[model samples]
Target: MAGLERQLTLRFLAEPADVNFGGKVHGGAVMKWIDLAGYACAAGWSGKYCITAYAGGIRFVKPIHVGNIVEVTAKVIYTGRTSMHLGVDVKAGDPKDQDRHLTTHCVLVMVAVDDEGQPTEVPDWKPELPADIELRESAIRLMEMRKKIGAEMQAHVDLQPSLQVP
Candidate 1:
C-alpha cells in the first residue's frame, strides 16, 4: 500500500560549533537532523510517541558547506504490529538553486508507544486510492532487508562470549 508522506525542512547555517576545522558540516550534526526528521514522521504517522529502533544504509552522498540549506523528507513506508519503517531523504543545496537536488536516502525503523511508554500496536492502515506502485515495491524491499538485518543482529548477539568475573 502506498504509505503516508511527512516532511521537515530546515536551513542549516554552519556555525563554527556545527562545523569542523576543515569547514564542512559535521556528519554528526547531519545525522542528528536525519534522526529527528525520521522520528517526527513516525510520530505523525502513528499518532503516538515513537522511538527510533534502527537506521539502515545511511550514506552521506555530498558535503554541506556553511550556508547550505538541508531539506529532509520523511515518509512512512511500511508498518508492522508495533513498528513502522520510515524513509528519510536529505538534500543539500542553496535554497535559491531549485535545480540542484541530490538525494541522501536512509531507512529508519521506529516503534510506537502507549501513554505508559510501552510498545503498542499501530492503528489500522488503509492505503488511499491511486497508490504509487513503485513506492510500494520499494517499501516491501526495505521491509525484507530490515528483517534480515534484525536476524543478523540477533545472531551476532547470541555469538558473543559472556564474561563471568571470578
Candidate 2:
C-alpha cells in the first residue's frame, strides 16, 4: 500500500493557542486533529459523509510543544458493512531539527451516512500488500477487544445510576 488512496495526512505547526496551561499541546486538540484526519480518510474512500463512531486505544506517547511541526496521519486499515476502521498517528518535532517522533496513536471507527443521516454501506476495501494485510488483522483484533469492553460496560451500566439515560 505504498500509494494507498485511503489515507490522509495533515501537517501543521503547533501554535500557542493549542498549548495548555502546562505549556504543552492539549490532548483535546490532538484528538480533534485525529478525528479530522480520520473523517477525511473515511469520507474520501466512501465518497459520503462519515461520522466518528468510536475512538479507542489513544495513547499519548510524548508531549507536543508549541512551535513544533505536527503531523497527523490517518489510514483506513479495515472496512465493514458501513464502518471504516482507521489507524491515526500524530507526530511532532522541532522545525529546526526536522526529526519527527510519534507523540500519539489511536484507532478510530467511522460510519458512512446518507443524506438523511442513515448509516449506508461503503465500498469494500481489500488489502493487497503485506503491510496492509497485517494492519487489517490488527484492526480485527482491536474490534474484538472493543466488543468485549462494550459488553462488560453494558453489563454494569444498570449498576451506576448516573450512567443511565433519563
Candidate 3:
C-alpha cells in the first residue's frame, strides 16, 4: 500500500435539530458524528468498508450549543490485524468568534470488512510523530483495560438472578 492516510476531519454547524431538552446538542448526536468520522477514517485507511467494534472513554467535556461550528476529527493511531483504533475528538464554538473548544473525546475501534461482511486485514499504521506514538500507546492500554472489563461483565451475566420475577 502507498503512504497511509491516517486522519479524517469533518466540519459542520450544530443545528437546532441536534439540541436536547437541556438546550445543548445532544450526546447521542455527538456520538453519531463520532461514529461517522471514525468509520470514514478507518475505511479510508483500510480501503474497505468498516464497522465499529468498540467505543470507549467517551467524555463530554462541555455542552455544545446550536449554531456553533462543530468539528469532529478522527485519527488512526493503531492497527491490529483487522482493526483500526481511532482517537476521535469533537469540538465546537461560535462561528462568529472562530474559536473552538473540545466538547467530547473518545477512542473507537473499527474493523475493516470484506464484501461478504467478514473481517478483513487493514494496512498497518506506524507512529511517525511523538503525539502519534503517545496515542498508539493509549490505545494499547485501553485494549488491556477492555479485556478486564469484558471479563467482569461476563461474570455479572453468568450470575443467577437474586430476585424472582412474578
Candidate 4:
C-alpha cells in the first residue's frame, strides 16, 4: 500500500570529529549513521525495537569532507516474516551547492525484537508502486546473493586449520 512511508532522512554536518586523518569522514562513522537511520525506520514500522541483522556490501563511492552537509535516507524496501530490508543512501554536498554527491549505498536487514530481546514477527510489506516493486525484486536478489556468498565463505572457513569448530 502506498501510504505513510516507513522511511527516515537524517541531515547533519560532517564535523571534524567525524573526519579521519585524510580530512574525510571515516567509513565506519557513515555506517553508524546508516545503521541508526535503518533502526529508526525499522522501529517505526514494526512498532518494536529493531536490531541490525545484516548490512550488505557498502562501498564508499566518494569521500565526504568535513563541514559538508551529510544526508542519509533509509527506507524499508521489502519485509519478510520478521525482518525488513532497508535501502540506505548517503550523500553529501556543500550547503551552497545544489549537487549532492553519492557517498555510499547499502541494504540492511533489521529484525524486530520483543521485551526479552528475542526476534518477533513483523508485518509484511507488499510493493504496489513500480519503484517499490523494483526495490523489492532487488532485495530478493540481494538476499539470494548473500546466501550464496555466505555459503562460499563458510566453505572456505571450514578448510582453515585454526577455524575448525571441533
* Top TM-score prediction, candidate number: 3
lDDT of 3 by residue, 87-114 (tens): 9999999998878999999999999999
- Candidates 1 and 3: which is better by TM-score? 3
lDDT of 4 by residue, 1-166 (tens): 2225688899999999998888889999999999999998888888888999999879899999989999999999999888999999999999788889899999999999999999988877888899999999999999999999999999999887884566
Clashes of each: 0, 0, 0, 0
RMSD of each: 3.5, 3.1, 1.8, 2.7
Model 1 Cα lDDT, one tens digit per residue, 33-146: 888888877787777889988888888888777677777777766677888777778887775676446547788888989989899987545445455345556778877877
Error of 4 at 125 (Å): 1.3
Off by over 4 Å in 3: 1-3, 162-166
TM-score of 2: 0.92
- Model 1 regions lying over 4 Å from their true place: 1-5, 8-11, 124-131, 164-166
In order of appearance, the predictions have TM-scores of 0.79, 0.92, 0.94, 0.92
Model 2's alpha-carbon lDDT is 0.93
